[model samples]
Target chain A: MEKLKYALFTGCTAKQSTPEQMMSTMAVANKLGIELVELTEASCCGASHLQDYDDFLSLVLNARNIAYAEKHGLTMVTICNTCQLNTAMTKHRLDNNEELKAKVNEKLAEVGLEYKGTSPVTHFLYAIIDDFGLDKLKEMVVTPLSQFNIAPFYGCHNIRPSELQNETHKSAENPYNPTSLDDLIIACGGMNVDYDEKNKCCGFHAELQSPHTAAALTGNAIAGAMDNNADWMVTPCPLCHLKLDTQADHASEAIGREVELPVLHMQQMVGLALGCTPAELGLKHHVTKVDFV
Target chain B: MSTEHKITTQNVNFKVFRFNADEDYLPYYEDYNMEVTSEEVVLDILNRIKWDHDGSFSYRRSCRHGICGACAIKVNGRSTLACKESMNDMIDLFGNELTIEPLSKKRAIKDMIIDKADFWDKHAAVQPYLVAEIDEAPTSENLVSPEEENALDDADLCIQCGACHYACPAVEHNEDFFGPAAFAAAYRFSADVRDHSETRLADVNEEKQGVWDCVKCFECAEACPKEINPIGKITKLHQMAFQEGIAKNNVAVRHAVGFKKSIVKNGVLDEGGLVLYSEGPAIVKHIPVALKMFSKGKIVPPWGITKSENLDEIKKLVKSSSTAKF
Candidate 1:
């Protein structure tokens, strides 16, 4: 068997706000023998905010990010849902429309780059199921998380608006009831806690706009998982993790109770099963304490 | 002589929502078992349930075709037009059991029917009508360029179905949110070259309840049956707000501008700086979380961060591609 390599595009949240996501992803990739080539030169994917501010700039920026992966001749894998959406959307638009591609390429030419659309963009959760088989993952799990009930939060960007998601990834999870995260949890020998808000938005993007509304949304999702007896919540997107972890105070206010739920990045949960130490996965960096370990 | 075509039948269990404000304090589901064929639409099944199983089974329906948008309901957790959704497709997507409910649980007035008063209120708040110049009543056909019409994109096709309104998580969580349907309607009228509504952009430029409140979840877009991307229209409203200098000092705009500035300047987001930039002095509210995050090594000081290696390239791209002033 050959090594599965990818151009790792760790968006700003994992790099800045939630460094543990980056740390755990690296540890898990190392354990799985998958080579991750970090795209250091890649800028932000506009985070859906910049796209609203300036769509052209967002398109060109994502075009540049994809062009770098095309330059590397490897598939671009993102740990963040918004990055996956924006980059995949950029690729989809570019690949389908020659005129749009030409406009983007004209911008890229100034930076001495070109988007050939050779590289496909995908979230790490999908990458695990598609590239690294769940069966292979099951075999590598030394410490199964059967003791804990894990709630899988499939954030909106990676799933909804299926037109873009289905175009980029080979096996797009059903947006209505996403099971890739749950399947991964089951593969790691963890019990999947069923909840209504499992496939709902975390309100991360609206945090800056309406903090109270965002908190209420997060509180509802966390409360739903808690009501179903989930020991901890896990998410593939760092933005969701950022909100689910950091907004405990506001979330508590909205839920009318003290809210304390340890939120883990998708890789950190996988790392636990892969026999990585809490320190190695940066679990201690979490605002919400990881007592389940 | 008649041509013969194969019709496959399968047993499907329909779990329909049962609620009456007059009698039921809480809503419940009633199960109806029926054998359905591939030729049937969801409306056909609903009609059969009302006609045969229970004449009391209640729902809304208008033009049986997909146009009227009156038969929109939740089918197997997705808000869709019952008249347009094929039985075969639903089965293919969600298996044998289908859960049917009203567009919104909170607004449910009866089985498969919701009080659309709030939806209409929000739509009205956006002033969803052609408001031409006060003095200029159309004496002749008002000409609109093809490009201007094309820019509306399928926004004109929206039948006010309320599917996007019900599907939006923002609206579900925040009552004040104008929702995707309202915003799409706003864009349709506001962006029209014919309608000279000066206050259209200002109307939807609110902080906690307007275009800014949209979380970019894309749920509304997914729920739109006509392929009218409501999120896209909402973003266009945001762009128009910025372009027309509407609500320049709004926190959402400030946050967005801050985000763009951070990316263009450093090639990546400075999370710490962004908080202060977005909230201004209100950053004091987040001091505890900031301190906690700093202690945990989740965040670092501005000086501690590394600028992107290709910062020059990023700056050039931003300067070249963006004409909108942040």
Candidate 2:
């Protein structure tokens, strides 16, 4: 098998609010023999917030971020769903529109970085399924997660806005009924617990705007998974993990119960199945204790 | 019937949401098993269920085409126009077993029929009409420029189906959120070069209930049968708010603006600074959460963080792109 290398784009949350996601991701990559070149020079992918303020600036910033992967001749792999969407949206726009590409490249030229649109942006969840085949991953599972029933939270940016997602991946999971996360859960020997809010938002974007609504959104998603008898929930986006883990108390207030469902990052779940110790995967940093592990 | 068109049939199990406001205190699913033709649409199946099986089975439909938007329903957990969804496509996507329900974030009036009163009320809140300052009734003439007309393509395609509105998670969580359809309608008229509505942007600029409330989930874009891309319109409305100098003091606006400033300064977002700046004195409320995160080693002091190595280039890119139009 050929070596799997990528320009790892760890968005803000994984580095700041949810560092465990980064730790677990690195551990999983090491075990899987995948070379991850951290894009230390790349700026934030605007996180959809910058796009709201200045779409042009967001585009240029993402163009610069993707340009790093172009420099390294590797595909950019993001662990944050928003980063994946914003960067891929930039790549899609720059590759499709000549005028926008010229303008972005002009900005990039001053920065000594020209976006040739050579790098394709994708989420790490997709990378595991597409680049690292599930069959191979199943073979590498040292400690199967057969004892747990996990719910896969396919947060909004990972799948929705299907147009860009489809353009980014040849076999993009259907946004209506996404199964990649479930497939990953199965590959790790965990039972897939289906729920209504599996594909919904975690209210990370709405946190500042409407605190109560954000809490309710988080509460509803957790409640949905918990109600369906899921032992724990796992998500591909660090932003979702942050909200689902940290604000779980506030979320409990919104749902009128003490809901404490442990949430894991996608890579952390895989790390456990790959025989990595709980502390080695940075499970101790989570607000909700991973007592199961 | 044309003999050239091959007729294929399959037995489809349809589990439809059944509820009548006057009778049932709780809603339940009713199943109807029927053999449907491959060429038929969801509307055709619904018609057969209502006419042949149960006359009490109710749903809204008109035009029998994609237009008029009355036939919008949840087919296999996705909001779509029943009249537009081909049976073969539905079967291919989901199996022959389908669970049909009314549009989510809505009150069910009966099987597949939702109460659209709030939907229209929110739509009305945006003043979904042209507010031109015409002195007299205009003669036959094209008022908008070709370029202006082209910009209105996506917003104008809205059929007012409420699919996008119901599909929105913001509306699902918060009642005050002027739903996606209203936002699209707001964009449709407010963005028209011919309309001179001074209050349109202000109307949708409410702190928590307006454009800021959108979760940016993009479910609205996926749910629109007409491909209206309502989230795209809401995003433009955010840009318009900034361009027009509306709601500068809003927390959401401040939060969005903080991202730009942070990126320009550090080449990365200063999350702590962002919350402090956006929330202002409201940051006091987050102290508990902050301390919890601090104890868990999730956050670091601002001085301890390392700045991106390409800060100079990122700053230059920001300076250059600031002057460039989107």
Candidate 3:
């Protein structure tokens, strides 16, 4: 198979807060023969934080970020669901409107940025599944994580609004119940389970806004996992992992139940699949102990 | 499962958020395995849970159909109109499992019953009723042109459902930001041709507490059962505010400009530069914050500018825009 290569867009959460995920991803990518060209100069994807403030401003901000990838002849692959969707939505907006495209190109010209819109924003989940097929993934898993009952958390911003996703992925993953992570988990020799809380927001973004509400929503997910007896909760977005992992103890109290569930990112799981021990996967940093790993 | 998948069972599990009438304790989830079918709507399941499983379970509903918008409960994290949403639709989207909770962004009273008091207050904050600019009362029945009526059609569909309000991140994050449903209501009056007081009504969005505060996540649009696109309307309100010169501050525009300039100059966002540009002299107030973040290692020094040769292309892109200046 041809080598898989793309520009890796690691937004704020991953870059500043959780760099271990990036390291684990690099480790996993090397094992899978995928090339990640880090866009070190790239800015924030103008997530809802910026976009909602001003539509046109965000459109151009994301447009410039995409232009960097286009300049290098690569599609933008983002780890954070928010960044992925933001860049995807910006591309979607640019693709349909010629006037916006022309104007955005002009703004890019000011600082030597121009986008042909050839580059598509892809979530890293799809990067592993659709880009590097699960069959290829299975061949690489040194250790099969068998019987590891995992509940897949597909964060809200990741899959819905089908227009933002690739047609192939849009068909492969349902917005209501996305299975890319599940399929990946299964490929790594893990069993994906069905639970009431399998697909929902971890309310990670809301912690700064409404701490109680965020805790309650996250608690709901843990409570659902408790009811279903999930050994671990795995998610793609770092923000979701942050809330689900760090907030589990507090989440348990808020939901008025005894609950504790460790959370893991896809790459860390990938690292484990490649035979990296829990210590190697940076599992020690996780607030909830994954002693089983 | 494909979209055709349906849950065919008499005892469908319902995990709902429950609180007591006494307001005595933290909220909890109570599972009720209801004798319901795939043909039933969520409202039917909820009614059955209240009537058969536990009579103490309190929820508000009137006009059992979609009109009243009283039974707006969150079905699996989405603020959905319980009366209209079908179980099969949910099954196709999600699986056979159903998790119900009280409307987000509000206080919970009892099982599936949220305090709509704050919701109604925000609704009233927008002055939902219309006021005609004409001083003289029309002798004949008030008539509106087709074009004007067409403009109102989208906003007219709001059933006073607080679904959008519950789904809005702005409402959840900023206490002051007028939410989607209220903004949609504000747009309805502002867009009305007969409403002469639109200029003053539009002034409501002039501050940080208004339309500009929205994070534009589009959750409201996703949650709205009527497909009102309240966030879309909120954007239109921003445009109106811009046009009417009600938006006095240059914060959003400055942020937008700063965001682009940093990209063009550095091929990345200059957080320091962005702060200077977006906040202007107000940057002094945030020096402590910058220091705090720096001590935390969150603030990484810029890697310095890359090749400026591509920057000309970015400049050309900036100059090509209709309004934005680099």
Candidate 4:
């Protein structure tokens, strides 16, 4: 396996809501000798906001971020699936639309950046599998995570339309149902639980508009994980972690039982194995604390 | 953190999304605190809000057991039938401070009741009724196996409540997208083993508004109250589209075909090859409108075309999985 370095683009939500995921991801990257360069001046990928409110703004904001990555001579790696999707989707459009490229380049010029559409945007999970090689990952764990049974929730962003994700890099054959997370978790020393509904989304889009259904949807996954006796629900995306973990308290109240399962970003679990403390990774702020080793 | 096992039996707050089109202002929240028991469905809590707090608080609800699908509303943020979701789950997930609202991205009829007439009209466009080409009434009854019945059950349980249609991003962005609920209903009649209508697939394929428009978000499956897997139904419809050779006019079909071709060849999606083959020159006619998008930098050549080194292993897994299926 060869070593790789990347300019890490921690999108807006990771800095605030799910910083633990970013820190732990960097921690694991450091442990594996994968250089993750932080892009401090990097702005938001406009996340779901641009998608929901304004397409024009979403494209511009995403274009600017891509221009930032392109200038750095580094391919971008994103922790947020929405950020990854937005950047990839934006990049796809920018490469094809000459007029959009001209207009966005004008916008980028305002910020002293240009759009060439050369660099690729990917999630951290894909980088580990593609760059580090799974066999190498399988070799690095100091502490075995055998006691923990996990349900790996791949939110919408990492694996979607072929235009959005390089499916070869993604784990699932069927775009909707991918088994990559199971393999990744196993390599990291955790037991993967096969729940009938593992591939489903946490209804994050619905969370902004219709929250009850979002709660129920999140609740179902938490309950399903608990029913399968999963110790912690491991997810690759921050949006799923935020919606599922922050909303679990509400899900438990709705279901009339304490659905106390904590959801962790995949990197946090890896960081723990690399001998990093939970406090260092911002694990304490999570709605449910994962006490298991 | 307190490990207080005792459940708090308090009156929970509901910050409801209130709307009346006659008013100058758009719909906004109006709070109501209500008492709830362990078994109270969200419909019960809303009914209490309507009856006691404000008589003007109007919402539609029929079968309280989630069979009617009429009481669907956005609790917190996800779409759900108010009848199916209990109050306990609400508090645990979002805390006692809750926000109840009608489905966003839809024309609100009054309070939580949305004008589903457009949905029904599009549904009718798909011709949802059984199109069986049989003359016999019945010798006895059309009995289906449990496995067969289970396969079709998810699509059948949809009560036409438009939560799925409301929650879907594709349907919201593209009005042409047949919307999740309609696609599910299309699958329901299409998959029915009892209906041997040759025109079944053709009828669905004929509609400009069909399964081809779906972005495969799985929001419909997430919103379904009966645990009727709409996502699986949509995928099955995609499979049917390919098997029946009806993939000609579908956007989603191209993805499925491309996926099959990729797996058979490189064991993954080849964006360059897929775009060249799937939406080629004939699709070039649509490229003019797509160019406005291109001008916006919304389209590009996929970053890389190189195949993964483990393509053989992925091929083996696909082969082994399919053989296991057989």
| Top DockQ prediction, candidate number | 2
Top-down DockQ ranking: 2, 1, 3, 4
For the predicted complex of model 2, DockQ is 0.78
> Which ten residues in a row are the worst by lDDT in model 2 chain A?
A167-176
Q: Name model 4 segments beyond 4 Å from true.
A: A1-28, A31-293, B1-8, B23-25, B134-141, B249-252, B282-306, B310-326
Q: Rank all candidate structures by their TM-score, best first, as comma-separated numbers.
A: 2, 1, 3, 4
Superior candidate under lDDT, 1 versus 4:
1
The per-model DockQ list reads 0.75, 0.78, 0.20, 0.03
Global lDDT of each model? 0.88, 0.88, 0.71, 0.67
Clashing pairs in 1: none
Interface RMSD of each: 1.2, 1.3, 5.5, 17.5
**By the DockQ metric, which is better: model 1 or model 2?**
2
lDDT of 4 by residue, A5-87 (tens): 88888775554445577678777887889988776655455444323223454566566666667778888888878777777
Q: State candidate 2's TM-score.
A: 0.97
Q: Candidate 2's residue-wise lDDT over A210-286, tens digit each?
A: 88888988999999999999999999998999899899889999879877799999999999999999887999898
Error of 3 at B281 (Å): 8.6
